[model samples]
Target: MNRTNCGYPLLFPRQNWRHYALRSLQFAVALYLLAFFLFPVGFLFLKALQNPDGTMGWGIIALLFANPVSWESLQNSLIVATGAACLAGSLALAAAALFWKSDIRPSPFMELCGFLPLFMPAFVLASSLDIIVGGHGGLPAMLQNLLGISRANASLLSLTLIEALHYFPFILIALHLSTRASSPQAHAMARLGTSWRRLIRQVFVPLALPGLAFAMALTFLKVIDDLATPLALGITNMLAPQAYHRIAVYGAQDPLAALIAAILFITSGLAWFASLGFIRQNVNLFPVTFNDNRPPPTSASMRGRFFITFLGVVYLGCYAGLILSSLAGVWSHTPLPETYVLTHYLKAFRFEMSSLYNTLIYCGFAALIDILVALPLAHAIAKAPPHWKQRLGWLVAGTLCIPGVTLGIAYLALFRDIQLPLSNLPLDATGLLLTLAFSIRGLPFALHICSLALNSVPASYIEAARTLGCAPAKIVSRIVFPMLRFGLLLAFTLCFSLAAVDLSLAALLVPNENNAPLAYSIYLHIQSPSGMNVGSALAIISFALLALILFGIIHRLHRRQGSHRTLSPPLFPTHRTTGFAHESSHH
Candidate 1:
């Protein structure tokens, strides 16, 4: 027997039943991943390449190449993505340095505020911008008067601005974690009398290059694949909205939509792979021991204070605009609303009260499914034979790079009329299909969180239990489950909130208003002429509820973990350095 470090055999299965069970579980997981993810994506390519008569069609490919709008959409996507990536990454880098590295007052609250937009759905932010900047024509009018810019130009800029704000948190968190990981090196460099600027240039930036690249790549992919922002802003010429528009106008029969989806799929896939490569290549560039010893905060500079204050004002303005827009009755010509009214909320609730139930039910089911499936999957990967671990990890992470829009389109193409296994029920009936879609979309997040939790558990603890003659089932229940409770809670909450606010999946997978979650409902409201205020109201409510629940749970988890262990690594891979990047760097 090949005994392992934990006193278990390298190939631990002694009973035939256990081996059969493990094989069965692996088979089931593989089947689901293939059917839901890989096969559907492959089907999307087939649909993109096929003629109306179900035969191969190369003419559509040529049409995509020749169409001016297709080319323009692609161009606009590249421009927007590049611009958003640069802006977001730069802003995040600056903000992370001030809030985390400097000796700022109320650092915890500042960090939370910085992270607020990550939990907010993009549509909510878009609606808020429309209300403050475009709905009343206040900011656009002011810009027109001062700079001779047109309202259309103002709207586009606002769109870009809001996108950068929404994505800033991804890079901010990434850089924050990466910087913390290299704090010892940073402090050592500081003791050598290195200026902040040079320290960043010589040590911090180089060490955190992987995280910065990952953040930029992730942001670019997100901006290009985003459907809600462009759609809410009435910018149908962009690639994501254009693809969605074709599907809405021509239904599933449109190959052009599939073609556009294929493009997004390829673009996002490449970005995702590039980010992973960067992170892997540089993760150990300046490796340090993980510990709880806190580094002394650096002295705050006047410049850092000013930068932090400016970012705070921006976030406060956006959040306030969202809340006020929901309550404002009208203010066409003035900077402020003419009257504050609660009617919007009243009307919105009257119409969408049922949608609240729908949101809760779908999110609840999605969370349950994610936890159930991801836990076992994480266990299998972490405990697998060493030869199989890397392959299994990659398989779980396969969808991490796929854009939500691409997955939404692929699911629509494949599950439009499919039947559920072992039941007479069709997949598309009564929002069941949407539920499954949300689960699949959120699986990667759940798996990642659980894997971290599982890996954190000591091998000696499990070995001791086994030596005491504990059954595997009992050990899992008494030891592993208890240890993972906080992580599982966090994962479930994140998965549920994500599902509830997923615009891409909800837009395509939801067949009717009854199936619409809060995000899709907000989209429909924003798009309807009579329902914009109602949409704003709904956005406010959803944003508030999500912030409250997620923040409350996360705060409690952090406090508990802080007592004994350190925080988890950043959700996205980004890195930071010695000080705020110079403001001119953004230019």
Candidate 2:
């Protein structure tokens, strides 16, 4: 029987029971996404455009257009977003070029270590920076006192720099993946005596443009939507901070806050679509092929080793600064902490244990729900009809484009007056809403990872099972599920860590102080004059927990990789089954 573009058999009629089941499952997932993800966002736009008199209008928008505060905030967001994206993209591209293309010989462990900042909470990273470089009490302040330079926080610059540090790894990883696919072009051009500069400018850059654009777009969205960094830095004029302040201070009844959220949502959506276009256009820009095109590994030069060492030391030093500050009894007016003790850690664990428990409960539940929702959607996307596939992609992308802050704002608007369907509880007053919000916000990540894993399942195995009269359910249980164990674990861990420290949703959706998660509690502590040490301690504990989970995932993945390598030599005849698809019969 012939197969459609995907691996499923086309000989089976469209109305086949299996196909119908798949369709029904996909339709259900589509409905869930629409009702829970898309509807709230649509309602946000509607609310922003509607006046209080229950009529369609754009008066608020008109007023916002005329407001100088809106324009200035927009201007600031654009400037900072653009600047941070460029800086991060350039630095990441350079790093990828050196590590992958040049004789850098950057150890895989070192490169992985460099990506640690990507998983750290934004507030934690921001707080770490303040400890290392804040005006009156940090190491940089001490240096400034000696140099006689004025020692006030450089708010905007500090934000940009902090964002760049957190975001560069994303671009670096994207470029690295792109280069993996296009390395033959680089090797072939270099063989013809092309200068490294020309090779990058003419060959690699165009090939990697899609990934580069995506990295920049993601960086921009993250920077623009960040409430923690600006709030932590005490910046009030920025767009995200301004929007947050309106609702946080004036309550959710403020129409102006909804207007700002609408603007943020629209801006985020435009950037996401624009970046998708760039990605699609650049995907096959340099079409070159080779039968066996792996490039030979290069050795590190002395200079290259020195460069990697320098970056490694700088990153380690920043982390050390956080750890040291967390342990300091009193750190003011000193080059280093005057007294180092375990009091801060004890205080955090003793006093903030409830907050930590709340984080686990919330994030653990969210991750579980995220996986449950993602698995069916991912399976459907991989096996659904073409038209349905496109619709599913849009659904996922639309959810991804909705910023977390916008989602929080949307939920706040939509459910502030609604109660649970059968219960007397207000929707916003229970942990259910928080968990639902987190699961929806994390859906895109879970779906993407699950889809990739599902795509990698060997078609031959499924075909063999089908030919033997095995049901679809049996094939999934015996073959697909077993192979996907690692990926599922990875998705769950990533979503859990992210949801655990998600201040954006918790800051708005959480019922009250008693139920706040660790990140929210840390933020609360950081806001007080005497609470910096406690906040540092909380940040330390949170970072350590997240790091442990991340490292566990990494270790398991590495072990799986090694096992795959050991088993591959004897698993089957030479046409290898990899992440997606097997070699054609010609091989």
Q: Global lDDT of each model?
A: 0.70, 0.70
What pairs collide in candidate 2?
none
Q: Which stretches of candidate 1 lie over 4 Å from their true place?
A: 1-12, 97-115, 134-155, 181-188, 280-306, 330-332, 346-351, 385-388, 419-426, 562-564, 567-587
Instruction: List runs of model 2 lying over 4 Å from the truth.
Output: 1-4, 8-24, 52-54, 103-118, 134-154, 180-192, 280-301, 387-391, 562-587
**lDDT per residue, candidate 1, 1-587, as tens digits?**
33442232322356757667776776787787788778988999999998766788787788787889899888778777888888888877776665434523334444454445445576576666556665634444555566778766665665677688788866775666556544455556667987767766765565556667876886787678778877666677778888888888987658888889999989877777766766532222112123335544445545556876776687668766667867888757787888999999999878787888888888889888888788768767756776576566655665766777777788777876778789876676558767877889789889877776676566677777778888877877887777778778878887888788777777777868876788788878877767777877888788678668756764664566545343353332223223333111100
Clashing pairs in 1: 174-574
Instruction: Write down the RMSD of all candidates, one decimal each.
Output: 5.5, 5.9
Tens-digit lDDT track for model 2 on 429-509?
997778888889788778776765665566777778878988767777898788778768877876887787677788888
As a whole number from 0 to 100, the lDDT of residue 184 in candidate 1 is 53
Ten-residue region with minimum lDDT total, candidate 2: 565-574
User: What are the models' TM-scores?
Assistant: 0.86, 0.85
At residue 288, give the lDDT of candidate 2: 17
How much is 205 displaced in model 1, in angstroms?
0.6
